[model samples]
Target: MNQNETQWDKLLKIKTTGRDDSHSDQYRYPYEPTSYMVLERLANSGLIRKNNTLLDYGTGKGRVCFYLSYQTRCRAIGIEYDEAIYQKAIANKETAVAGNRSSFILCGAENYEVPVDVDRCYFFNPFSVEIFHTVLAKLYESYYEKPRELLLFFYYPSEDYISSLMTQEQLMFYDEIDTSDLFSGDDNRERIMIFKVI
Candidate 1:
């Protein structure tokens, strides 16, 4: 990478937040500060246009979806597996929306049904490989039915697994945001990968 890119990666590392593995079945990781930057970049680049539907898989505290709605005019929906996290997401939505456009669901990604109109999806390392595959299968089915453009924003992505899934589905890389600095640790090399369905 160039010097500029190296600097950007370092900057992101300062804002990365480590994953919370406290709960066995609950994948409730807090949003990193760099996530806002990624959201803004996507919005500014016209990747997440106004009026488009956005789904935040495993949304904790609804931070990603809330920021999406607050920054842009996009309709946002968040799904959380943990009851406590779901409740927190609801509360956060209420405070952020103040009678605006946003919603939340208390369900796991595998069990949750994807909306017909959802055009964009966000996943912040929300699930294990098994659950991720399950959610991806649902998304593929939905794409086949609707035949609409779908954008996936995956933070701290598992590139190999995602690539395998993308082979069957028409997905192209849109952007990648380095996020190594957002957490407090020595290993700072996290990234957010954005993909667009063709």
Candidate 2:
């Protein structure tokens, strides 16, 4: 953990943990906290604004939601299917500085209804490609119904996710933010990939 993370927790009063595959299955993936460094970069990337509402798919413990809410002052909704994890997020909600700006939903992304006004979505390799596509389809439905601009922010994307996202006709590459130096990974794919609807 970094000093920023310590301060963030101290100021906000929350604790987010890492991967726990023991509770994961086909539809749900393990809970791994996105690196705070990567999140800090995304928060300052200018891809999102205060006017936008961001949806965090599989938002475990609501770290992304609260962080971005603090950083950008934008509204955020975190979705988590795991009951235990969702409840934990709800607990964190009580103390979050951005609690008013951030909320948690206890439902799977594939079934959750995408809010019409949401212009940004986030993922952290949260689920399988099948569930991801389902969530994308719902987003597509919302887009067609309202036809507004939308951006999907993916962090430390996996090959399965990259391949699936690239084939989506509605999304185009907007930008990328590299964070490979933050870790000891050999593959330089340690980056945040931003995609916007075409």
Candidate 3:
């Protein structure tokens, strides 16, 4: 963990400053927490509101759920497939500043059901494009059952993920949150892609 990550973890009263690639496979991605700086930018973007409920896929240690809920006052639900990592998230919630506004569930992203109140969703390439399609289907089902504004946020998306998302007729490109300046790399993928249900 770096100085910024440690400071943020200390401030949040949680321990989510590590990466775990042991569980990664062809379908499921590894556990990597989103940086505090990038999360701070997302929180200040004004896209998510207090009334909205955000669903986080592959929420390792529940960092996004805790940080976003704390910063935006929006209800957050984190879905984790790994039992051990899910336990860590549960532990973190016990002392998180926004614990009351956050919840965590242990289940595969493709099998998890999307709640109708979940207007915003966050993804960090948690799984392969095939599984993402299943999750997206669930989101669309929820949207169709209860028509409302639905926003999908993808940070550091891979080419496969972006291409599949672009072809989805139910979703339209909404906006982008650039984070290239925050890091030293000239990588073009250092940004968040925002899509809305159409």
Candidate 4:
């Protein structure tokens, strides 16, 4: 963790740092917290609003949920598969400034049932393309049932993931929130790709 990351955690009253690959495999990826700077940029992008409910797939330690809810006053739900990390998210919620607006689910991203009100969804290379397909199917089902506006945000996506998303028939490219300038590299994956469910 860096100084700024630690400072953000302290300010938010949540400890969501470090990387854990203990449970990673061919499908699900490791647990890594999104940077505060990226989250700040997302919060200010005007995509998330106070009335919007954002569902974060693979929300390790609830950093995205807590920070977004705090910054945007939106209802944030974090779906974490790892029991240990899920518990940590729950603990963080107990003390988080936006705890009332945040919640965590102890379930795999593929098996999670997308609620009707969850209009905003976020992914960060959390799982394999197969699992991502399954999750997108679930989201599509929800969209058909409720017939509401839905947006999918993918940050630092893998090439495979991007390819898979590009092939989805029902998903149309919406917008991109560039974060390449925030980091010290020429990496092309430093951006949030948004897709609209149609």
Clashes of 2: 0
Order of models, best lDDT first: 3, 4, 2, 1
Q: What is candidate 4's lDDT per residue for 41-65, written digit by digit as tens?
A: 9999999999999999999899999
What residue pairs are clashing in model 3? none
Residues 31-146, candidate 3: write the lDDT tens digits.
99999999999999999889999999999899999999999999999999999999999999999888999999999999988999999999999999999999999999999999
Whole-model lDDT, model 4: 0.93
Per-residue lDDT of 4-67 in model 2, one digit per residue for the tens?
A: 7667766777777556676798767899888778888888888888999999998988888988
lDDT of 2: 0.87
- Each candidate's root-mean-square deviation in Å? 6.9, 1.4, 0.7, 0.7
Pairs that collide, model 2: none
TM-scores for candidates 1 onward, in order: 0.74, 0.94, 0.98, 0.98
TM value for model 1: 0.74
* Candidate 2 wrongly placed segments (more than 4 Å): 1-4
Best by lDDT: 3
Tell me the spans in candidate 1 whose CA falls farther than 4 Å from its real position: 1-21, 25-34, 159-170, 177-189
Worst lDDT window (10 residues) for model 1? 9-18
lDDT of each: 0.67, 0.87, 0.95, 0.93
Once fitted onto the true fold, the runs of candidate 3 whose alpha carbons sit more than 4 angstroms away are none
